[model samples]
Target: MYEDFGEILINGGNRGLGLGFVKQLLSQAPQKIFATYRSAETAKELLELATNNPRVLIPILADSTCEEDVSNVAKMVSQETNKLDLVINCVGYLHNAEHGPEKSLRQINANQLLESAKMNALPTLLLAKYFQKLLKHDQPSVFSAISA
Candidate 1:
């Protein structure tokens, strides 16, 4: 399926399964792979990949949870390409230094829950809102949100 794609976008492509996808898809001959990373400090590997394959990989600094960033990313992508063949949203928030899996109902903090929702759910909505235009095509295109 990926062989048919000329352009693709991968959110949270700095590490984990997102990074794995980036590595695997490099062999698929896509013209461009727009990969979003949260920060340079955490995105060294992704940056190196972009540097090594400048023509194929683009490392965009963005926070998927931020609507403004998501909007800006779509605008930036629009400037480069008229259409995206595939969009793989791999961003997710499970736990951090301040929060972990709630062991019981009493442990569920409202603020933590909101934070989780912001990262886990809001990005997909914002991506669809801002990038729906880019995904439209006579051929097949996809906007996939993978929650993990």
Candidate 2:
């Protein structure tokens, strides 16, 4: 998939599995990579990893839940590049510190479920909504979400 150089964007790329995906994708030698993290401080490792790698671009302080943040990122991508080959949405929230879904109907709370849906599902739809124009007409484009 990385044979032909192209731009890729990844959200929620501070740590864990999102970081792993960035590492593997870097190995493929894409033309450019724009990785967004919710907190700039949490992206120190990613910043260190990007040193000496010109293709890697770290755009910090983007919260997927915010409309302004999403719009800013879309604008940034449009100004800097002509086409976006891939956009991967890796943002999600598990219920509290327990780090798992509600065990039963009794445990479910409307607030928690709503938060989960907003974090896990809404961003993907939002990304598509904002950046659909950057996607090529003939060339294939991919929008994916990773959730727990």
Best by lDDT: 1
**What's the lDDT for candidate 2?**
0.78
- Which regions of candidate 2 are displaced past 4 Å? 98-100
Show where candidate 1 strays beyond 4 Å: none
Candidate 2 clashing pairs, residues 3+ apart or interchain: none
Error at 137, model 1, angstroms: 0.5
RMSD of each: 1.2, 1.8
Per-residue CA lDDT of model 1 for 1-148, tens digit only, reads 7798889999999998789889989988889999999999989999999999987999899999998999999999998999999888999967889888888999999999998999989989998998889899887998898885
How many clashing residue pairs appear in each of the predictions shown?
0, 0
lDDT of 1: 0.91
Give one digit per residue, the lDDT tens place, for model 2 in 7-100.
7888887787777778888889777777888876888877877775754665556898888899999888778888888888888766668546
Least accurate 10 contiguous residues by lDDT in model 2: 52-61
lDDT of each: 0.91, 0.78
